[model samples]
Target chain A: MTYIIKGDGSKEKYDEKKLAKSLKRAGADKHTIEQIKALVRKKIYNGMTTKELFGLAFREFRKLQPIVAPKYDLKGALYRFGRSGFPFEALIERILVFQGFECRRNVTSHGKAVTHEIDVKAKKGSQVLMVECKHKSKEHLTIHIQTPLYVYARFLDVKKEFTKPMLATNTKFSGHSTRYAKSVGLRLLGWSYPKDDSLQSNIEKYKAYPITMLRGITPDLLERCIKKEVLLLSDIHGKSPEQLATLLGIAFQKAKKIAEQCKVCELK
Target chain B: MTYIIKGDGSKEKYDEKKLAKSLKRAGADKHTIEQIKALVRKKIYNGMTTKELFGLAFREFRKLQPIVAPKYDLKGALYRFGRSGFPFEALIERILVFQGFECRRNVTSHGKAVTHEIDVKAKKGSQVLMVECKHKSKEHLTIHIQTPLYVYARFLDVKKEFTKPMLATNTKFSGHSTRYAKSVGLRLLGWSYPKDDSLQSNIEKYKAYPITMLRGITPDLLERCIKKEVLLLSDIHGKSPEQLATLLGIAFQKAKKIAEQCKVCELK
Candidate 1:
């Protein structure tokens, strides 16, 4: 899983639960998430890289974000990455997907007269984490003030079932900004570079959060475990010649030979 | 300006003129180049970065390439950089604009059945240059084979006024492919890393070639020159008053006073 520090110097895993929560928080409806999922699944192919998936999700989300914005100006702002912000969104999404979460990029909420879009949405089990990712230089940390405003817009669109709002940024938050988030009951997931010990702890803490908050088995974790198993099995299959390996620590060829004999006996 | 080495292990400058020639050779119509120049000029704003302008022109040219392809695709191929072969037709236009060339990124012909577009048209003295650009990886070179084919299709559309063909790649070309291009008389511009001095010389040799048969410009010189200028200006702008005084061989107070004067005079 890709890991990043949250705005409050906490390490957070970019997982499916986090993505779902983020989407819900960003005001995406269940229908929208399902639509996005369908689009991503259809586009997916074998040996697909994480970056490719993120890009696909991003393009899909971009189409949706405009539909949710309140005004054309707001829609423009969401689409505008101002250079550096462009690649950062994809990187964040990739991290989340790697950590075992299902994520969609550029989610938009369509309303009667107004629309809103979130950068990413991650869902795992019942916990739906909404993330607002910012990639500003350290000197521009003061820009954190705008983060909540964007998050609040998303918060209004989230379904009632999800818990907790989180903001993620590559830049550290100012003390004043942290205090404001705390007062407002918003979770700040911040990370400091050069080996941030605090971030590591936050990941561990969040991992233990009650699973009931998540819908079911975290899709992100399940995917990761499955991928790992597939990789291990493929490695074994490469070395072993037998269809069935022996229970004992025998050579793969011997196991395959035994399996073939067993198959012959069964055939007879 | 981005510089790159050619396939023959030579360094080359990404000259706007060379790009223009490639576009002309690709069979782009004069009207297309004119339209592109106007568009770029109209959309340009103060403090616009080179990369931003390139993207703007690329988008514009993407809208026009299909229209002029009947006569221009062969020469236009040299401007593409990436795998998608989406026309970066505005690259030369942007380069020229950066160098004070009066070029525009405008639309020429619109596709009725296809949504694809072309970028811009360029004029140097009496000559008009039509271009498209591709930004691609070396591993994905095959992705661009269809580009020439598309240009060929466009050639058929316009009644064959444009006759030049050009192909540019940031990655190295395969020997078999190079031989194929040579056999067919297609101009292939392959670019690689620019740090090598020998490669740079080869690029220079290609640069000296007439636009009629030239493939593409080297990305190394263009990128280096732009980088040097940007870096120098950034450093100069970041200096403290005291530092400026030392550099100018003047007293700190006097230097501050002069700096203020220079700022007022727009001389800094």
Candidate 2:
């Protein structure tokens, strides 16, 4: 079979049949050659550039080699999972940052009490949260049997006020295992593929807002805003922000400001 | 913060603060509880239903755990790479099937010459292709070293006439390693995430088509198709039946028949 290279190479046409023959001669089985041929045939489009096609064909043919398969599969799986856009660990850090927390990944702590590498160390206000992450195939089960050990280790290292330990998995946990986690006071979080609504909501909720919104925003500033009636927080049932803002004779921002103040006041 | 319990539950109005305190009492970290509360606040719409927020919170929380973080991250990567929609191995198999071959996944073989479990096995006519898929993290560099052993093992198990060994990985190969593989005549396929079209095209070039296409077809028939211009036997180019049949002025069944016949003829 002849292949017309579609990319920017000078040699635009090559005999794929010859290539297969060469591969067979070079120790590729006839079946493997045929497989290669079929693959090439299925994907070639009209007006495809030669360089592109050759690169594509070369990579595909390479798969028949033993050394490249595992890494290829891992990379493939990673891309499928959306980690290709950004380093997965980095994305986690970004999410943590957006959530109004400071986070560190792959942190190790060593002390007389414990020795462990935490996937993430997060601080919100006075609380310190240690996070561990595991990425494995479905056949590999995830259990946070080491949570207590890590907690103990962290206790030895920082001696900060301890918060509950956190464990996360892409897969679901066994009922008994989850119960065990609960029994030990470890918090468990599971995330599956195709970001579900609840997860998305969490992401959105924690996302950082624009700096303009932060103007004069101190923890106690909400109290002043509420006292001055610069905003009014009310239960306007089933009203859109625009509708409610219009009814209250305020800008959406002012209404949102009022809501924020109310929340702070309520919390206090 | 008040929550409402719906249906079958004895309680109607439940206090959200009470629930948060209970979770805190249950050993949930303050940060996690806060994250959960934010998640609930963002998602709770008018007429918001039950207080199953704890379960939702638990699910979200699990993704952040260390022991399981890798699994979730990998899943996200796989989904991004387009493998998460199906069983992890199925995507690999599908690519092989697209090359017009009968493919099986996760086959175990044990023999004096070969003792290993192969991730995929593909057959076309007389040729048998053994594939091993390794999904590894940086922590497991050993996966890269294992491919050659797997190939050698597979090569030993099958009679020289029937078997061909292949490897697929998501990682890039080192120069020295690539040279070593080429020296041994092993086929190596590599893919990175984010679905590089070029790489995918390369993968497509070597992928085997579904075995069903070979039904009622013989190697001679395929050769005849090639000779008679009934079907084009090109290397992995325009090979998908749905695409090829239309261009060739034949039904996919007819094209498949011709191709299978060619496969049979080639085997002879």
For candidate 1, write residues A152-249 as lDDT tens digits.
43453354523556676555666645654554455565544213433222322232111111112234432432333321111233234443333324
Per-residue CA lDDT of model 1 for B1-268, tens digit only, reads: 4443454445554444554554454344566566656665676554554445455555555467543232222222233231233223333343434434455554454322222233444455654433334455333354233343333233222213223333444455555344434433444544532233221123232221111111222344224323333111122344567875666454687545433322211211
lDDT of 2 by residue, B1-268 (tens): 5545553444455456865775453345677668767887776554344535544655555534322212212222332331222233454666667667799877766533223456787898887877755444332143333344335334544434337766665455444334435544555665432235322344334432222123333545444443344321223233566655664456887765444333422210
Shift in Å, residue B154, candidate 2: 3.7
iRMS of each prediction in angstroms?
Answer: 24.0, 18.3
lDDT of 1 at B152: 29
RMSD per candidate (Å) reads 24.5, 33.2
Regions of model 1 farther than 4 Å from truth? A1-83, A98-100, A111-113, A138-140, A159-163, A193-268, B1-268
By lDDT, who's the top model here? 2
User: What is residue A225's positional error in candidate 2, in angstroms?
Assistant: 68
